[model samples]
Target: MLILGAHYRLAFTHSILAFSQVINAATHYQLDYPDLALILALVRGGSLARASQLLKVDVSTVFRAVRRLEAALGQQLFEKSRAGYLPTTLAQSLAEQAERAEQALEAARIGVEQGGEVISGIVRLTCTDSVLQGLLLPALAQFMPNYPALTLELSTSNDFANLSRRDADIALRLTRTPPEHLVGRRLADISYRVCASERYLQSVNTTDLASLTWIAPDDFLPDHPTVSWRRQTLPGVTPGYRCNSMLSVTELVRAGLGVAALPDFLIGDGLRPLGEPLHGYDTVLWLLTRPDCRALRSVVTLFDELGRALKLP
Candidate 1:
């Protein structure tokens, strides 16, 4: 009876050990470093062209790598549709794991480089094209050279990037309200003015704003605050030309094509103010950084410089 009991106990112990070994083997399976790199690059880039640029490889290479990964995984990582490569649940999980691995590697590298007193690292920033061209460019010129060891990656997009996913380290946004997840300072209250070229104004009745030809944002920017403001301020008025780009709208207005509500910063020597600044169309500028990133020396330094420079008078 004792021998029988001992045999049962030994079998149970062997089963447990086998289970642990299986888990360990699955978890520590030799990961293909190149495939991991490709996955991370594609996930971050959002498109093939962008991924190619990031990976310094051709589009075909990216396509081949993605196909190979999908085949090996025996599951579709991304949905290929008209909207482009939308990540599947599996892809998200894989990408997140890859990100963690990359972060660990970066931490190791930074740990090794800690001997240097200089604050040196990469900081990714995202903002609208207008902000990039008008506000951030000058600010970066001053801030970047001051930190010779730091590198900046600027991404321009009309829509907000997902900061929680580390899409960017910081964001410069114009909004009446900032996102709850982000931590930042309200930099300024931005306002837009009704403006047109002198020649354009002469061609229309400035006294009756509703009667003037206007250039406005197209369907692409359906939720543009100006669109609602225009509808309320000038009922029955439709724009003479529709464009997606604010810069293009300004140029069209300057070419005597139509009048537009141009932002205060963009109102320069060429345009003449027609009316008092529009109400209910004002938005505040915010310089935002993730809570986790605020402690990083490079992020804090750039945040301070931008805060000082972009703050409203």
Candidate 2:
């Protein structure tokens, strides 16, 4: 009886160990193929609502795919929140490679088909909201008209798109150096200034940068990306009103609520640009891609066209 019990215990232990191995493999194993990339793209697109609307699928379907993705990978891609699901650390890291691979495959297909080789796909592009509005919109309008067959999948988020994980096929980043092992170009300089509505400016406490309330990102968390950005750019300045929505911030600013740092593109008819830029700060927008697909004809065509379209000169 004791011998029998020992054998059963050993069997149970082996089963448990095997299960753990399977879980680990799903979480850490490198991902390949386009379906995973597409699902990942949808998740990266934004909130579940936004992703669903953009994907032109039911939110329930998106949720199902998300569940299946998690189940198959044996890992949680996002942390559940009342607002929506937020990506996890693992998701952030892995996203770049999947994005790059997806890009490579598409480029290969495009090259093949355009040269009598088979091809058809959508290109995933990631860029800042500011860049998308100010620059990319016009460029895309022109590019799309020419390539009626090609689809442009654009993802605009404050989060840095991970090129290595394949978070984006092409990314317009406001940084000098691209991620390690990726190829990129420092495209142009982006500048921002404190702006306010004339009505609001008239009622302000002062025109001086120091003596006024401000519209800024919420600083509830220490690691908040926007807070970090604000601190780096405007240290010692306190944010009077903090909110997450860019539209909200702009609307508040437009209502003459307070002076806020805004990009040149965000400066519209009702609002006005301050005399001086915020701390005289500027960021470089970079065009990034994986080294593997750098030489592909389709990739080259995109880079050449996009580069020309986004030219500063």
Candidate 3:
């Protein structure tokens, strides 16, 4: 009984020492604490070479920093294999925490820069080609001069900007249904009309619109309002030219390739409206922002300005 108790006491003391070492390593890991950026770069870049490129550092520097971090933490943070350096579970958790910390830092920095009085900093705005070129640019010509400290980054894409990912501060989307996660006001219903160049109209019979060769959006964009409306309204009509880009379709129509459904804003470029505006093709233009984005002073100011400009008669 005495021997067993002595062995148990020794084992218990050894376990305590091991636990203390772990705690010391965690608390005293000074090099690891500030190297959260390095950790995130490594995980996101997937390899030392990639990480070095992303961080604009020498590969040796990245390797040394990671080595120091691992030594300070007293554990392996990644597994090296033929594929690449895959982050361990601990490293994954650290990267997530680092991301959160980075976001917080950015928010604080933005706040300090704005100083509550000045409406400044970059406001990323996304929209389709027609909205960006036709409507928003003209409004911005007046809006930007008034806010000299503000910077606007415009991204034109057909795909909806993912506000949840912070892809853009604001998005001008043409849709009947906007995503529920975003908050915004519908600006106005964008009108769509069938248009053809004067040169094309001379060749094709205007009386029988269904018999004319059409310039259509590609099958990939079956959900586009113009594409869907065409399919439903004009049965048995096929396109002579198919394109995925609305801007390209407009250019094709202007070149007299075929008649296409186009927005009213684009009609002045040597393309004449065919008939009355096509039914079921008009979609509301929405100015959208994430809940967090709506709180930013610069974003709020720009959002309101864009809303007013778009709603004007």
Structure candidate 3, residue pairs in collision: none
C-alpha TM-scores of all predictions: 0.62, 0.56, 0.62
Q: Give the C-alpha miss distance for residue 19 in model 2, angstroms.
A: 31
lDDT of 3 by residue, 1-313 (tens): 1122333344334433433343334456543335778888999999999999988999999999889878877878899999888999777876766654554344434444555334555789998887787788888987777765566888887766556678898999888899999899988888899999999988888888789889888976789888888889887898889997788889999998889999777787689998998776788888999888867888999999988888845
Q: How high is the CA lDDT of each candidate model?
A: 0.75, 0.64, 0.78
Q: Which candidate model has the greater TM-score, 1 or 2?
A: 1
Query: Considering every candidate listed, which one attains the maximal lDDT?
Result: 3
In model 1, the worst 10-residue window by lDDT is 1-10
Please identify which of the two predictions, 2 or 3, would achieve the higher lDDT against the true structure.
3
lDDT of 3: 0.78
* Model 1 CA deviation exceeding 4 Å by range: 1-116
